[model samples]
Target: MLRAAAATHLRRHIITQRRRIATPESIRAVAVDPSGSLTPRAVDLATLRKTTGAPLRDLLNLDIGERTRRQRRACVLPRDKAVLLQLGGLTAVINADEALFFDNGGEERPRAALRRIGASVEFAFQHYKAPAFELAVLEAVLAEVSSSFQRRRDLYEPVVQKQLREASCEFDGFGVDGLHRLSAFDGALMSFEAETRQALQVLDELLASDEDMLGLLLSERRAGTSVDPERHGVVELLLEAYHRRLSAVAGDVAELRGKVQAATELGRVTIDLNRNNIIKFNLYLSMSAVGLAATTSIAGIFGMNLVSGIEEAPLAFGAVTAGSGLVGAAVVAGFHAAMRSQKSIEQRARHAADDREALTSLLANMATVENVFDDACRDLTRPAIAARLEAATGKKPSEREVEILFDIFDASHNDKISLREARSALHRGDAHPLIT
Candidate 1:
């Protein structure tokens, strides 16, 4: 009887345990702020533990603002003899005027920017195989970007242009109803924004997949890398694609900067032209004064008491007056020419100086472009750069130089530097040719 009773008790205990859900041994939580205003007062962990009943877990530094990102980790503790880890951005407080809310860990992290531009990467990769391939990989990449932009233009151009043209010339925004109707941009811009997001997602996927293959590609970056050279030439193609893409984007950015500088140059040129016009007006005014004085001389002679029959013969009087006016005009013009000879040369010198200054500014911009080009090359074609340097400089570089060059190639330019540009830059800097 005792043995049967003990067996029943054990069974009952098992049943009770099975029916109750065991609470986790430790519970942890973290907070994220999208408001940017929630700068928490500095908390002394020890004091907090003493003042409040809450246990001290860990401290995290975070930045939260409009388009800002913050990451936090919860306390690590054993739960039911097992580790329990929770990773996400669920605890966040967002506020108005912020463009985005990044909590809940849904948004991609910082290192994934490359993923945002995948179409460009694929377009750049066509150069992995034979050099004799019909299409220039660079051109192919540019065409793709152009196609994408053109597609966007087709969708939004008409609407934007129309709105810009038809918008009430009244630029006021204080009115209640009219303010609401104010133009931020063409309504099509919003539509494009949505499409851009979808395109970005697609690009992100492509880049993500490319990154998965990075380890393999990196290892193959050694001499004569080939993955089925007869077929895909996977790594080579991918590298070329990236090169083209970076170059194209960089070129666009460069072109925009160039245009801005050009506009500034134009403004300066206009000022100079206005100055020249002023000088020309001054000469015209001086000539006009001489003609007036000459006419007055004829009038003075005609008014003399011994005028005789000059006034009676109108035709002779007119001829003599005209001849005097012509001679006076010639004298004025000669004086003007002499004055111009003295000062115009000086004006030319000043204009030349201005031109020199403008040229210097252009050189500075070009230098910046050179740096951008070097960076792109390092990122897209490090091996090619390294090989080129080795052939030219005879003085073998240490691993550091090679590393530095590769870094320079990537960090210098934001896009691809053309072979001509790269070579010229080297020559300008007193560096040897890559091949020579």
Candidate 2:
């Protein structure tokens, strides 16, 4: 009696364990026929999981199923005969011909998904709305991604053009909105690239894997049937075509990236030019203030408590006033001459036919005015200026030669450089041969 009770208790415990079910989430399982007929039926999550052998956790947590969760465009699980595809704003799942379309409480189906994969297949028995072939499901995913990107590219290109057009207009330049738009577009492209790469990777794996062959042979073995080479060839051909299509799309993405980079470069140059003009205006204002300050200092000195004998003379007041006026005028004239000379040098350098000469002239002005060359002379590690010099001359310039060039560049004016003076300076300093 004791043995009988123990056996019965163990059997009851086993029965309870077997009856335990996973969490209940309602789902629709649509059975697809090669005859192009779809029969959708509602099923519980547990039943669906059992039927497809897909993990319940993976289905619930979409990220768990992703090979590249953060950046994956598509994922294929050929072992389970399943695929997860993100197309536009929709995510679709395919288990061979049967699919579980996640509705997210929406009324309308993903038109992009349905249009590509849901073609009519007429079998000997009947006509059904289903994927014509197993590979057609993957093709739909690719089509949706390509179409979405094309639409985005079309919308984005015009915006970029507008930004480029308005680049000349200071107030209307691609200031904030342009940057935001570009960032958004770039992000979209990056996502597209990642998805395309993932898709290609999956296809390549599929082509290399013996898993499909094993599955086919195993199923046939169970049924006591033979393998069909023609059916297998069709799958291989479709896979190759898909790979080629992805390769072409990748090329398009690369071209788009290039155009965006060019547009960004132009925008940056415009901003830099605007900044330089502002700097020029500020320098002019500072020079004016300095001249006025000089005049004020002279007047202040004359107004001191100590009276001179010249104050008693009739013409003393006028002479002192005239002397102060002349002093201020001289200071202003000197500043104006210096600025004018600098401007002339810059204009000449910009218009120079020889790039080397132009670069030298530019460096000269920057050396004297901005003291860039002084710092560079002290520190040989200034690679930016070094690079500029090398590009112009096709040779790495020595520190001493760079210093000599700075002095000669400063002296250049109106596209004319005193080559004799430069050569003499080079001889005295570095003994480097002048380019002239």
Candidate 3:
């Protein structure tokens, strides 16, 4: 009797602990019934498994683990008649007649995604008794994902533009704060790009899985049976629409990355150019110091008590002063000339490299043209070439500069420049290329 009583007590304690573990604070969920009414509830993973009738393995897959480390994935189980979507911290599980959302914290209750799904469900209720609700859920999820990405992009793009503008205006005056800000922006951009890419990949996978499931359903149909147009067409159209939307998000991300890269490159070049100027200035200062020291040494020798007889000669002081002055001036002039020549060489080398890169870009762009050519050479007009040059160099050249470049590249005296002529001019290194 004592042992049986102890066992009963233990069983009651275990049930109490389970209840505590499944408290509303730990997990929040909402179920959308066929009637489009939402029933909010609190359920742990164990209760979720029991309610959904999903197997242990499937329920384990829903475990979001550390929210920060969660990966985006979509799992469609045709046999179990369940669709699972995990987007960062949010998880959505859709069954045949009901959809359940599990919020593991971070996002607000009844997320935009959930609201979208709810709206779609309500709309479907008016048309058919049993709509392809899974497609609607998928579409809603994708739309929400795309919308979130766009919002983030909108927030980031303006900041990026503002930073770029500020950096451009004060490029030469960039201090520690400016550099730190640039680094922070770079890190943010990298993180944003990574997240956008992951989101895009998840969308692609979900769409592909949906299509595969559709194909499988079609294959299982009776031979020579006409497929339901509404069922298949709606799925195709929905997927295509989301695909385009997500693709645009991806394109925006790409554009943002390009701008970030340009900003980074500009900062790097500005810093390098400033450092080179400082080094040159220091070199000039050192040369001047050496010349002054040489003149000072001559004056010191004459002032010594045991001076040479030349110091006592008539007009010797004036001659010595003139000679020392001449020597110092000659030394300064020689060093200055040498440094100037070195600077010129560096400038020429950098210009040559930039021209070669611009030529390569022009040729690549012209290669995309199918039939537009003149005398067996792919040619681009002045404005077209100028745009390509700006893209390649990340700096826009003035109209006069573009005109000059076009004249240089147009060896045949034609208004348009050909790829062959640009390439030849850059390779020969004789033509003066436009400095970007």
lDDT of 1: 0.35
What lDDT would candidate 3 get against the real structure? 0.58
Candidate 3 lDDT at 302 equals: 72
Candidate order, lDDT descending = 3, 2, 1
lDDT of 3 at 421: 67
Q: Write the per-residue lDDT of candidate 2 for residues 21-45, one digit (tens) a residue.
A: 3435455444444444556655565
Q: How many collisions per candidate?
A: 17, 6, 0
In model 1, which regions exceed 4 Å deviation? 1-233, 248-250, 253-287, 303-436
Query: How many pairs of residues collide in model 1?
Result: 17
Worst 10 residues of 3 by lDDT: 367-376
Residue pairs with colliding backbones in model 3 are none
lDDT of each: 0.35, 0.49, 0.58
Please say which candidate is ahead in lDDT: 1 or 2. Answer: 2
lDDT of 1 at 219: 22
lDDT of 1 at 430: 28
TM-score per candidate, in order?
Answer: 0.23, 0.51, 0.56
Query: lDDT per residue, candidate 3, 274-339, as tens digits?
Result: 899999999999999999999999988876866568866999989989999999999999999999
